[model samples]
Target chain A: MIRQFGLPEALAILSGVQATILLSLIAFVGGGVVGLAVALMRTSERTWLQRCAGFYIDFFQGTPLLMQLFLVFYGLPVLGYKVNPWIAVAIGFTLHASAFLGEIWRGSIQAVPRGQTEAAYALGLSYASRMRNVVLPQAMRISVAPTVGFMVQLIKGTSLAAIIGFVELSRAAQIIASATYKPLLAYGCAAIVYFVLCFPLSRLSMRLEKRFAVKT
Target chain B: MTYQFDFSVLLPYWEQLLRGCWLTILLSAISISAGLTIGILTALAKRSRFTTARIAAGTYVEIIRNTPFLVQVFFIFFGLPALGISFQPWSAAILALSLNCGAFSAEVIRGGIDAIARGQYEAGTALGLKPLQIFRHIVLKPALRIIFPALSGQFVLTLLTTSIVSSISAEELTSIAQSIDTLTFRSFEIYIVATILYLTMSFGFATLFKLIDRVYFSYPVK
Candidate 1:
C-alpha cells in the first residue's frame, strides 16, 4: 500500500531531527574531552607522544568516515563484543571528531605567542600551571570560531549513520520516500530541516571568525 | 575471544577491488574537472555586475553548503525521476559530486579573485591589453597561484567524498567492499584493507599536489 506524502509523512521525517541533534551533541562533547588530551599530546615535548598523536590524527583524517564506521561496527563483533548501529555510530563519530578537533586545537595552542610561555617560565611557573593558566586560555579563545564551524560539519556527518540503519534524519527520509514513492518531498523536507539546523551555526561561525580576526 | 582472522579469503577478489579503485579514480577525475569549470563560472557570476546573477550564484552556494551531500544525491537520483528526469546511478553520482564541489570551490576561487588588486587590471589596460587579455595576463595566473593550495586540498576532499556515492549503489571502492562483505563474511578484514587503500590514495594525492605546487606556483627568485 502506497501512502500519500501528506503532513503525517513529512512529520515522520521531521521527527528524525531529534536523533540527528542528539548524535551530534554526543559526538561533540565526547570528542572534545578526548580531543583535548590528543591536542596536548601533539604539542608536548615528547617525540614519541607527538608521533603517536600525529599518526592518530592522520589515520582518521585520511580515510572515509563510512569505512571507519564499518570498521567499528564489524570489528567489534570479531572481538566478541555485541554491537548495535547506535553504539557503533557513536564510537565512530567520536573518534572522527577527536582527530579533527585535536588538530584544530593543536594549531590554536601553537598560535599562542612564544613570549607568553617565556613569561610564565620566568615567573617560576611549573609546566602544568603555565599551560593551564597562560597558554590554554588564549588557545581556547582562538579555537572557538573553528570549533563552532566544526559543529556544522558534525551535524551533516550524522546523516551518514543512516546508511548503517541508525534511523536518523536521512534514514527517516529514505523510509518515507520509499514508502510513499515521493522521493522529492521526502528528501527535500529532510534537507530543509538540516538547513534550518545548520545555517544559523554556519552564520555564527563566520561572524565569530570575523570578530576574532578584527580583534587579533 | 577465539575468533580467527582470515584475510586470504579476499585475495581471490583482488581484481574486483582493483576495478573498484579504477572506477573511483575515474569518477573523481571527471567530477573534479567538471566541478572546477562550474566553480569558475559560478565565481564569476557571484562577482558579476548584474544583481540577478549574483543572487542566483549566492543562493546556490548557500543551499548546497548548508545541506548534507547524501540528501542531495537522493534528491537528484530518485527525486528527479518524478519530474521525468532520470539518470543512471553513475551519472547521478557525478552530477551530485560536481554540483557539490562547484559550490565549495566557488567560494575558494572567489577569495582568490578578490585578492588581486584593482591596479593590476588598470596596469594591463594601460599596457594596451584588451579586457580578455587583461584577465588572462594580469588576473588568472596570480589568482591561481594564490588559491592552488586550498584548491588542491578541496580536491583531495572531493576524492574522499566519492566514497559517499556508494550509498546510491554507484560502483566504487566502498560499494565493492560491501558486496565482498556479504560474500565472505570477513567484514572487518575487507574494511581494513579498503581503509588502507583510501589512506594510500589520499596521501599519494597530497604528495602529488605539493609537487605540482612547487613546479607551477613557485615564483623565480632573483
Candidate 2:
C-alpha cells in the first residue's frame, strides 16, 4: 500500500537535514585544515612541494566526486580497512573539498600585494611569522566571499552521499518517494528544503563579494 | 592486505567503457549547446525592459541555481511521470543538465553583458545601428570574449555533472562502471578507470577551450 504524503513523511525527510548539515560541516572544517597546508605548499619556494600540491589539486578537481566516493567506499576494503558509508563519504568529501579550497586560497595568497611580502622580509620577519601576521590575514579577507560561495557548493554536494546509500536528505526523500509513490511531492519537498538551506548562503556570498570588491 | 588488485578483470569490458565515454560526450555536447541557448535568452530576458520578463527569468535562475542537480534530475525523471509528463531517461537527463547549466551560464553571461560599457551601446546608436544590430555588433562579441573562459569552465563542469544522471539509469560512464562492478566484483578497479577517463576528458576539454580562446578571442578589436 502506498503511504500518503503526509506531515509525518515530510518530517522524516526533514530529519535528514541534520546529517546533511553535519556532513557539510565535517567536510568544511577538515578540508579547511588540509587545504591551508596545500595552499601554503603551493605558494612555498620549493618547486617539488608546489608540484606535488599542484598535482593533488589537479587530480581531485579533474575527477568526479562520485568516483572519488566510490574509490574510498570500495578501495578501503581491498586495503583491509573496514569501511562504512559515513566514513567513506566523509573521506571523499574532505579530500575533494581540500583540493578546491586549496586552489581558491592559493589564488588569494598570491593576490596579496608583493610589496607587503617584501616589507615583511625587510622587517626581519621569519617566513612563518610573515605569513601568519602579514599575509594570511589579508588573504583570509579576500577569500571570505569565495569560501562562503564554496560552502553553498559543499552543501549541495552533500546530497550526493545519497547515491552511496548514506541516508542524507536526498536519500531520505528517495525512501519517502518510493514508499508513498508520490515522487513529485517527495522530490519537490526535498528541492524546496535544499533551496531554503542554500539560497541564503548564495546571497551572502554575493554580498560579501560586492563588499570586498568595493574595499579592494 | 590479502586482496590482490586485479585490473585485468576489467580488460574485457573496454568496449563498453568506450561506448559509455562516447555517450557521456554526446550528452554533454547536446546539453552544453542547449544550455548556452537557454542561458543567452534567459540572460537577455533578465535584462529586458519588462518587469514580468525580468522577474520570471530571475526566478528561474534562482530556483535552478539554489537546488541540487540530482534532485532536479529526480524531479524531472521520476516525479514528472506522476503528472503524466514522463520522459525517457536520456531525455530527462538532458533536460535537467541543460536547465542547470542554463541557470549558471545565465549569471555568467549577464555578468559579461553588464561589463560592457554604456558608451558602447550609445556608440552603436550614434552609428545608426538598429537595437538588434547594436547588440550583435557592439555588445555580444566583447561580452562573449570576456566570459569565454568562464563559460568554458562551466561547460567542463557540466561535463563532470553528467555522471550524476546515472542515478536515473541514464546510460553514462558511471553507470557502465557500476554495471561492470556488478559483473566482475571489481568495483575499485572499475571506478578508478572511470575516474581516470573523466580526468582525461575534463583536461582534454580544458585544453580545447584554451585553443579556441587563442584562435578566436585573441584578436584585439579596434
User: How many backbone clashes are present in model 1?
Assistant: 0
The C-alpha lDDT values of all candidates are: 0.93, 0.94
DockQ of the two-chain complex in candidate 1: 0.88
My TM-score estimates for the predictions, one after another, are 0.98, 0.98
Q: Proportion of native contacts in model 1?
A: 0.89
The list of candidate 2 runs beyond 4 A from truth reads: none
lDDT of 2: 0.94
Q: In model 1, which regions exceed 4 Å deviation?
A: none
Candidate 1, residue A203: the lDDT equals: 94
Model 1, range B1-222, lDDT digits (tens) per residue?
888999999999999999988898899889999999999899999999999999999999989889999999999999999999999999999999999999999999999999999999989989999988887667777887899999998888888889999999999999999999999999999999999988988898889889988987888711
TM-score of model 1 relative to the true fold? Answer: 0.98
Q: Score the docking of each candidate (DockQ).
A: 0.88, 0.88
lDDT of 2 by residue, B109-182 (tens): 99999999999999999999999999987888889999999999999999999999999999999999999999
